[model samples]
Target: MRVAITGSTGRLGRALMAAFGDAPFTGPSGPVGWDRAAFDLDDAARTADALLDRDRPEVVVHAAAWTDVDGCARDGELARRRNGDATGALARACAKRGVDLIVISTNEVFDGTRRDGRGYAPDDPAGPANAYGASKLEGECQATAAYDAADATGRLAIVRTAWLFGPGAPDFPHKIVRAGEKALRAGSSLWAVGDEWGTPTYTHDLAEALVWLVGEDAVVAPGERVAIHHIVGGGLASRADWARDVLGRVGLDVTVDEVPGSTWSRASTPPAWAVLAPTPLPGREPLRPWPEAMADYALSLRRSRTASNSTTRA
Candidate 1:
């Protein structure tokens, strides 16, 4: 099928491109990799025309969004425009052309008010604590409305994930490794928030699942046309856990000081525990544990640095 992906240069987007490259798919002009330069999602008409009239893709995986949590909190209007308005525009465009849309969303939609120690399910009511979450919630609403307006034949799947990390782009996991290394070098202890908890998702696995969802056999059965799936790594972990694991994997001898979330101040307040429960698909397998994923990421970073060093020396 003709597939298109926005945010082609991003962490998840790059992994999606790699995953689709290994699969059986095609795009309008080579692989449908549209970076920010190719299409500005803010321009609704232009974006629609480019995807519908020009490319005419069978599936459009909407992965682009303003992911900077602090920045989103700083400017609510920009967040709404990029994450909320742009998503609505894409959904409408996709609906007009009968193109399937798979939107990548976050787990920050929840306020973490539950003390049950269980992860958030897809059907749970969302109560955003920050502007970023609010904008993403708006995006979800717009996508759902578009699907409903188009008669809801399961043409849309909202995949909500959390704490994504991979090789293509720097993320929280990488930051942990970097911080640990710096602390080790300086003979200092790294402070990590112990109260915050979430499932860390690997982008490569997420990309694979997204491609599977777009396939012919992955359709939602009759009755429900719009589906919401929570695809995250198995098990839950806090920031301190992540830091210790990252340090261990990197062979760092640094001390990780577990601290409260309040110790770190930012423009936006994140959910203390917003882990996402994996979708209960009949035959779907759960993703690998966060520690295993982190190990792989650490190794990959080492290889990347080695290659860079070799190039510099040569």
Candidate 2:
């Protein structure tokens, strides 16, 4: 299929590119990496015409957005344009072209008000407390609306994920690991927020699942014309606990000091708990646990550094 992915250089976008590159997606033109330079998404009509005129992709994965939580809180209008308005425009463009649309969203759509701590289901009500979450929720609404306006045969899937970590992106888990290593070297304790809890998703796994959803009939038989799935890691952890785990995996003897989430006062309010419950598909294996994925990720980073060091020495 002719796949087009926005935010092609982003954390999840890079993974999507890698995963789809490995998959058997036959097209007159391969996957189009549509970055910000391609078109101004803020202008819906112009964006649609320009993108369609350039690359008529069969599948469009909308992943670009203003993900900076604090930044979004500071500038609500920019956040709305990038995350909300842009997505709606993209969805409309895809619908008009009869292209399958897969919109990558976040777990922040919830207000962090879950008492059960079991995580938010796809069908649960969304009440965003911050601009970031609010904009994403709006984007979701717009995507659904655009899909509804399209012909009944087209597909639109909204995949909500959380706490994503991968090779290329500057994710929280990797940052924690780096900080722990530094603290270990300095014989100091690393401080992390204990109050906030969320699921840690591996971008590699998430990307593969996205590809499966788009094409692999063996993995998921299409049950809904427009589907919503919660795609996240199998396990949940507090920020401090997750940091401590990363430290342990990296063979660091440093202590991780647990602090309140409120201690790191920022422009936006964080969710106390925003873990996303992964939806099970028909023939796919369960996603690996967060701990397992983290361990592997840590080891890979180490290996990469070692290789780089060897090359430098030579």
Candidate 3:
């Protein structure tokens, strides 16, 4: 399989690159990576042209989007253009060229009003509460519309995930650990929201699933050309719970103060119940629990710190 990944510099994109590195895949010369400089999503016309004229991979993983929730709330039009229009352009190009597409989406599309403590399935109704989620939902619509209009014989899968944490980026786990260390130094405690809930997914694990989706071994059910799949960590956690778990894994003795989600002021209002029930591909097991993945991330951080200290000493 010839695979191309957009947003090559992002946390998930980096993991996808690393995951595909071990697989029997290649582009014209090697694996195709399109960072912002190489493929700007904002310029829809140019993006479509580039995809149609220049890089023609067998599968294009559309991962580029304005992921800043607060920023999206501040500029809804920008979000719509980047996330919605850009995705439409890419999808149209892919549909026309008969290239398979894997669109990476978010769990924010749902309204998060479920009080039953159950995870949102892929087929659940979407009612975005914020500008970012609305924009992503629009993107999903555009992609589907494009493929439908073209009647293209290419596979299209929308993967919705949540709370991704991994190495090489300051993700949620890293942020919590960093804040906890700072608070410990100040002899204080860290504060986290107790109401907001979601599953903390690992980027590497999600990337592996995507690899299988694009590989020959993956089975697309009959009459299912366009499908949606929820790929997330095994269990769920509130913000405070995630914070405490991260701190504990990293050996931080700082206390975590559990607070209400309302106390935290932000431009975008995240879903209060953001959990997603992962629907793994057939024959593939669900991702491991988040705590296990967090342990690996903590160990990686320690190794990195140790290597940096050794280099400094040398």
TM-score of every model?
0.93, 0.91, 0.94
lDDT of each: 0.82, 0.82, 0.85
Which segments of model 3 are wrong by more than 4 Å?
A: 27-30, 217-219, 304-314
lDDT by residue (tens digit), candidate 2, 12-79: 88888888877786443457887767656567557766886688777888878888899999999989
Check candidate 2 and list the clashing pairs.
none
Question: What TM-score does model 3 achieve against the real structure?
Answer: 0.94
lDDT of 3 by residue, 39-86 (tens): 787787577668556876878888888998999999999999999889
Which runs of model 2 end up more than 4 angstroms from their true locations? 27-29, 217-223, 304-314
Write the residue-wise lDDT of candidate 1 on 128-246 in tens digits. 99999999999999988988898433388889999898976677766776787678768899999999999999998888887777654464544566788999988889989887887
User: What lDDT does candidate 2 reach at residue 272?
Assistant: 89
Q: Among these predicted structures, which one has the highest lDDT? A: 3
Model 1 bad stretches (over 4 Å): 25-30, 151-154, 305-314
